[model samples]
Target chain A: MATINDVAKRANVGRGTVSRVINNEPFVSEETRKKVLKAIEELNYHPSSFARGLASQNSYTIGVIMDNTMDKVYANPFIYEVFRGVEKSVYEGGYNLLLLGKNTYQNGKLAVERVLQGKMVDGLILQEQIIDSEYFKNIEQYNIPIVSIGKLENRDDISWIDIDNHMAGYMAAEYLYSRGYKKIAFEGVELEKIFARERYEGYKEFIGSKGLSVMEANELLQNIEGVICLDNIYAYKILQRCKKINKKVPEEIGIITFDNYPLAEYLQPSVTNIEIDLFQLGLCAGSEMLNKLRNRNCEVNRIRIPVSVNIRETTR
Target chain B: MATINDVAKRANVGRGTVSRVINNEPFVSEETRKKVLKAIEELNYHPSSFARGLASQNSYTIGVIMDNTMDKVYANPFIYEVFRGVEKSVYEGGYNLLLLGKNTYQNGKLAVERVLQGKMVDGLILQEQIIDSEYFKNIEQYNIPIVSIGKLENRDDISWIDIDNHMAGYMAAEYLYSRGYKKIAFEGVELEKIFARERYEGYKEFIGSKGLSVMEANELLQNIEGVICLDNIYAYKILQRCKKINKKVPEEIGIITFDNYPLAEYLQPSVTNIEIDLFQLGLCAGSEMLNKLRNRNCEVNRIRIPVSVNIRETTR
Candidate 1:
């Protein structure tokens, strides 16, 4: 088989010049590059990736690490959209995506150990679901560039891109309140997740500002005239519960939720929802990670994706 | 800053001994292994993945190449479930997944070139949507083991795992036909896709066996009492169209579809669907690829995943 030496010998250039041409490194003269290319084409030489990696110290691959278990990631379509966005940017940036499942790590330390030991990826895009985890702290030792999908509390070392969860919640609540529904119920908040908690806080802040007390879901369903759900899936359940209780939607009770999933439009009373652009969020995260990978001093380290409310039949 | 030589010197062993210990290769004595481990820990030596990869000639990562575009993959929840299954098995097997999107390849040759030149992954799990593509033909040159998610026609070089689309379609037709529905309509058949075409053939074969004529979706909706949809998304569309035409589901018209997605039960008149175990399919593909990667001679090359029907409100 043909080797780099063979190509260099044929081109009458040094091995370094051949390596530069093969790696597409700048500074090589056009005359020398043309000779190297012709020699490479004639010799049918293909550079080994390991050799390339050893030369550049870059894998041209990004690791997408999800904190949530596989089941949880697949359960929510929002994650898929974000992944699609990340996939698009990664592909456009000339990098492959390495999906590291939750099981790949015991904790943050193990995850960092695996990445460092394997030199598996050039950079990482982490999906931080839990707020209090020590993942980011442990990852600091590696000095590898990382971009997170969700914000980390009390940590500025890593870059992140996230939807404005608080604003999403506030919009849902404010829309329902403006529809004259005094009693509103908030559902599906897992305080462990930073985003969910932020959304919940936004809802409470909106209700507090209006001088309207936030009611429990059960209480609101029986007495209140409206409910702001956490997401489209939650909205579907609320709609089902309303049917069981013989209450008419948008008449006796109005509804609004987050995530304008297809089900929101397909439901009997199509749900009014906060359209969080998960795809754009993924794209932002990918771009941030790419920037960090390409440039050590990336000026814009954090990004907040905006959300919009899509009014539907649930709000009448 | 610590290197393998430092660990080898500390352990009182040769560099090859330390290399074998780090690579986890067989033939190294347990006592020597323990000594090397202690030295490695004491020195805090981190092995360069490129150097390790060169020694072992394995990346410990598998590439998942999707034939269809990212949008199509994300549009259907089934793909996510399949990916979850693959992710689970891949994680358990101690390998990372590299997602290669459609845009990665300009053509079959370029796709093969990227995989070969980069040495990006040890093996590949290809999602083949079309049978007539030159992808498999070109991939034959690379001698790289591959496991396809769907079956391919006229090619036995690579292994594949797929649900029995013909059976799935037949079962749907049989169930709806038994319920006293004649002149049933089959929705969403793209002849280019093997599974879709298989399903269409199954439906046609069933209709032919019963000496009945298949009606168009428009005609069936106007006259027939039942319809067999292509999948859950198609079923949802059918339901929407029914509502638009003032036709009540199940009461005035019955429906059954493929892929019992989560929203199937949530629909007003819940859809009866063919429940395909996509996660299991993914697991099978992952396992098949792993076996091929680990063993040159695998017992089972072709696997057909089973599918069942879930009767719901749409059928009742």
Candidate 2:
């Protein structure tokens, strides 16, 4: 219920002084600033965000653009963890988060246009795996700072944070091969996805270097000793297929997957997985976006997050 | 890239007229509205959201207040599903979603005050199980409409949507009992939660009515034949405990749980569960909130979503 007038009266300053203090403008003296802050604390006066935004020409809010549909995003727990990470960083930076999705608007163009033209958010964090060059062209015209969560194609203008998927796959294959498994297979969906494809290529490279042929479905009869699953869902499907064929896990076959999902631990034979810190990925993207928004000369342009393998029951 | 001037020129109207049309202000004739609409569509001039918000006094944005910490919300798949439903409904209504959390701010009070006093969002959807009365009082003081996802303790002024936990529990108990399992146990977490307590109470009522004693942990030694888990996570834990004790699933024990999580189908014995339509629950809450925001005298105040039983391998 307290207003700017009350704060000004308590702090013994004009309304404009209080406004400047609230907006963090560098005109007020230290003593005056301290007095105004104390008065604000005492009055418990929360300024209207609209007024603050209009005065400062900044909303103190970050916009998160999710490229995936609601169903896909919700179904994959990875996205949730990433969002949580981004949210934590944004909150710590004293900024609000606005979720903008392509599926939320009539088309992807509209979604991008809304964010670019809104002039409501200070920065943007994009979580699109495959970036459209045309969309980036539109975003480039704006002065808004952006950070992508995954590697974007044909974009060197903005920063991005992602894990080394190829390294993850190479390590997964090497771990299985080191455990005395000769026949190894890679299971994945959406071969067109950059991450999935990179992982598969890495697995193939490791297998080829070891002078071992990649096991195909027909070769399952000849004993596929190890399977590198692209993700937890694929790992579960592989387990189901093994169960159907009466192939005992860990005893006759070993499995390693990406993204250590919660269900992985609860499965009968807990899955071994390459744990890419999804929350950390989100946090890094958010932090980078904040950095860019604060300092246009931010030096860090690209960041690669590391991945660790969680050795569980499935990998013996 | 299209400007308001272009739209006005194309529509043969003044810039102010174009602005009024975009803001949906009255006094613009029907024929003029059509011309402006056509012009806007052709030119693809997306107005600045800040300008639109200032002019219309509505942001067309909904704030989702979460009581849980970011980590907790991210870990729970049920929350994700509910969020998906809310997102779907909000998107269909052409509104953006802003996520605000207690942990995001210094405290719950600050979080509530920020959302209520910010004047940045049109309405709010609260997902907290236990809301503070003081916070609700503050929210009530504001003209902002609110919709709670769960049942609140004291206040009935705001609308809420939730599943019939009592009925869900009763049905679970009936199913286990009908399977000729005399020794039945109820497993739950967070007894403080209303839904959990209601479920436990329902299970107890059914057992007492049948003249059977509720089995305790010590009673498990005397052959507890069936276990009704409060949720999927507890169900996973129960299975782990059973495995540790060398009790084979289904043949020696049967289990049923709430929330048919994705892992439930992939679990070794494939958990039987009470399938609460979490998505539908979210959809109803979101739609109801939108209706209330548009119409002050919304007919529906409280909505109870239905639940069904998914008979899987564990309940045989």
Report the lDDT tens digits of candidate 1 across residue range A1-316.
Answer: 5779999999999999999997689999999999999999898787666766766787777888654454533356567667777877886776768876554542233544566665768887877663236655565566778787888776677788999999988888898888888888788877887788988999999999999897768833778788888766777888888888888888888888887664446555678888888879988998888898789887747688999988889876
- Each model's TM-score, in the order given? 0.79, 0.81
lDDT of 1: 0.76
Worst 10 residues of 1 chain B by lDDT: B103-112
The collision pairs in model 1 are: none
lDDT of each: 0.76, 0.77
Q: Against the true two-chain complex, what DockQ does each candidate achieve?
A: 0.35, 0.36
Error of 1 at A149 (Å): 0.8
lDDT for model 2, please.
0.77
Q: How high is the lDDT of residue A311 in model 2?
A: 91
